[model samples]
Target chain A: MSKTKNFAVVLSAVVLVCCGALILGQKVNAAGEGKITGTVKLDGTAPHMKGIDMGKDPFCSKAHATDPGKMETYVVGSGGGLENVVLYITEGLTGPAASQTATTEPVFDQKNCMYTPHVLALDVDQKFKVTTSDQTTHNIHPLPNPMTGNIPWNQSQPPGAAPVEKSWKAPEVIPVQCNIHPWMHGWFVVVKGPYATSDSNGAYTINNVPPGSYTVTAWHEAAGTQTQKVTVAAGGSGSANFTFKAK
Target chain B: MQRNNLRKWSSVFGAAAVVAFAMPSSAQQTKYDFETRMNIESHVGNITGHAKDAKPDYRRYCVGCHGELGDGNGENFPWVDPKPRNFQLGVFKCRSTPTGTLPTDQDLFDSIGRGFDRSNMPQWSTFTKQERTDLVAWVKHFSPRWVGEKPGTPITIPPEPEVTPERIKAGREVFARVQCWKCHGVLGQGDGPSAATLTDDLGRPIAPFNFAEGARPKCGDTDKDIYRIFMTGLDGTPMPSFADNIKPDEAWDLVFYLRTLMSQHSKEKAMAKQLGLKPVDPNAPAGQQ
Candidate 1:
């Protein structure tokens, strides 16, 4: 009778320890996983964007139809919010988070003689693809600042051509343009860690940020860069807002 | 024993299948096709008149000489003299632009429209304005050097001074002072004393500009082109810039003299053609054959 009682106690202890370990493992996995969310706003009235002259290419002119394509240098949103601002953790990232590889390849598409995304952000060493959907041929040229250590490249993609896949070895803010179509321009803001571009609503969220104090930088093509410091708690959230004044 | 044999066969078949599947995927792995493929699907339902009827078809005219990839190693490369311009290197011999910079769109258009004299490149002036524009745009895709590079601003040419006998005489002196005869022989036949030893930056044997053949100068035959070449020398070759060494007026004189050399060569060639005789190679010495 005593032996049976001891066996029951031992089994219960074993079950309790196993259950505790499983729960602890789940908690450990969730630790240091936080998100940074914010809005990028414009402090002043947005500048009037100049109309693009697509007369050089008939295909481009026809694509826009009646409406003239305007310069996308500044894309302002409702409530004075600025769009396409790249917010990324510029400092204090280490270990796995600093070297994390992006699983999904970021795509930059040229459609209707314009870059679909005026601005795009991706991590360093991540595969980036440039595709053209227009009937007219487009030459995709990315001119990275020589200081960024990323070499500049140019390639032409005809209609029905496969997407050009490439990856940058270092972080850079690359200005992409088509020599054939001067008005067609865009940017590839490559970052080292988690990053996000503000949407039409001017809201952005950078998730999977390891819990730490970091200097988050907000970059706009025209307005330049703004940075802020924020601390993220374990499995918690942080915020860093930015505002740019008209030049 | 039968089971073992069956197992071995099954493994071999599995390996063979894997290899076959892998081969096609590898072949299709290029990010972009070197040759442009027609988009049949996009053009299928062309109820709209907006669809373009004329497209720049490089394959029909250029691929035979310029190569499918524009590397200048086309199928007819062996038969062509002086070879076609290799677009991959982004080095264009004919341009108003300074060295290390791309040519202006107008420069490319002129080359394509006028054609290179004495070479196999035919004048493509028959192409429509739109076709020429499209071709120019298409050719830029051959090199990555065009990316982010602004075309070199053309050097302004002062109006030509009168081309008199005295000007030509001074030009001859200027030419000799610049040692033009070192590569271009005393008669401008491209067989000077140093011609045998001349090499480009890449150590490739380079032929000096043969002025006695009436061939089109690489930078164009215009007075402005000659002046430009004098100011901004050809890059990656033995040509050195005379911008600092020579005055503008002296450069004009040199141009006048070079023109005379070209005209003299053309006159000789015309005479030979009229006589139905093989034109003599001025570079070759007598009694050499």
Candidate 2:
């Protein structure tokens, strides 16, 4: 009974301490642009998708134990496209953030019959040129849009594949699938933001943000959402790090 | 004592009965998460710990409806319209191709994360993805028929046909020859010859007019749509794909003919059934009735 009482008291104390720290932390932070970056990890229960038949495709056939591409995975890397993992301001949220519709061409390659960039982020009203690096035929199937219901866009990119890009003029979580292989899927996240994608090393830097009190949020395709207050001084890069837990 | 004997006989004959399994897990497997492909460690890790966690979840959110074993017959079974899925039985509908085969992880994910647009199944996206993932895995554990085969098989498909008008017309002629107009209604309204007799995965009659109808099934909504339908019959019901009888070209023609049926009843029946007013004439025939 005494141990139980002690455990209850300790739990209550921990809660109060966390709440107190949150309040003090919010008040002490001054306004400015802070950098937020960290590895977007996949921590929860993964799907029971059986191992794909590597048949004869070499790249996907085999690789290192940790090479995400080899594991029949959808890792949040350059290959994942970093789409829809929304990183925005959470608490201490202040003035609006910078944004734009840059119609840049992000390559959605199907090298060796796999959807490169398992996740990707794009600007709204922007046209993204997507092309396959594989010799197999591919189809760009954007979700939620009835217009391109399967997009009526299908083509084959032959070996030594010359780049054949398709533009996504509208914003959507379009899943670009290979007509050759049905299970292959990749995501295209389209948004209007002063947003920057995390690099291959799980790093992201959004430049030119005006100084203000913002709760920067980092979204990961698997680890879930992460939010923290960040202050950016004029023309200065503030520092912030987000850590996610895999349940 | 009699009940004990009933259990043994029951499992032998009605082993897959709808009322014998547990309620479905709220978490569904959707499109393969590109980020979190499976690791055997995670599979084993979760399985080791899943049983303990599964009990409470089943009791609190599922038992009242899905039954102790996930057979879709809890105490509240009478109230649910389409009844919860009988996981033990493993009959699933609404697959991309209409075949009632074992559901893909993504298919289950779609059902859990994004509740059916028109059904009573509620979306459990509010639950953590891990929770959802664990739940789906645990549900798969409910049935041991697939232990060694591995999970989530890739969906194979037919070769694409040339989408020219001539091919489309030729496809239509083949469609007529197959008498597809019978149950899917002449208009593809799913009211074809076998339409009225067709019961969905949940035991409800289903009509097949599917060109832009309420919500298109997960499979494509194109000529390829017909191809898959023809290849694998929709699971849980009478809609089998024609892979056995029709060639790819003929399947395409069936699709073209089906498209004509799509426009036939693509609108919602906003007028609630004025059931009391002039009951439909029985035996009057499909079109006239």
Using Cα atoms with residue i matched to residue i, what is each candidate's TM-score against the true structure? 0.45, 0.36
Docking class for candidate 2: incorrect
Candidate 1 segments whose C-alpha is farther than 4 A from its true place: A1-31, B1-289
> lDDT by residue for model 2 over B212-270, one digit each (tens)?
36555444454564465456555444444444346655666555545444433421111
| Candidate 2: stretches off by over 4 Å | A1-247, B1-64, B94-101, B123-128, B148-155, B158-162, B200-213, B218-227, B249-257, B264-289
Residue pairs in candidate 1 whose N, alpha carbon or C atoms collide under 3 angstroms: none
Q: Chain A TM-score, candidate 2? A: 0.60
Residue-wise C-alpha lDDT for candidate 1, range A3-42, written one tens digit per residue? 6555545654554554443335334335668999989999
Which CAPRI category fits model 1? Answer: incorrect
lDDT of each prediction vs. the true structure?
0.69, 0.48
lDDT of 2 by residue, A178-205 (tens): 4234456666665444455555545667
Chain B TM-scores, listed for every candidate in order, come to 0.67, 0.58
lDDT of 1 by residue, B112-189 (tens): 888876779888899865566566666666665455345678656678886666666666666655556556766678
TM-score of 2: 0.36
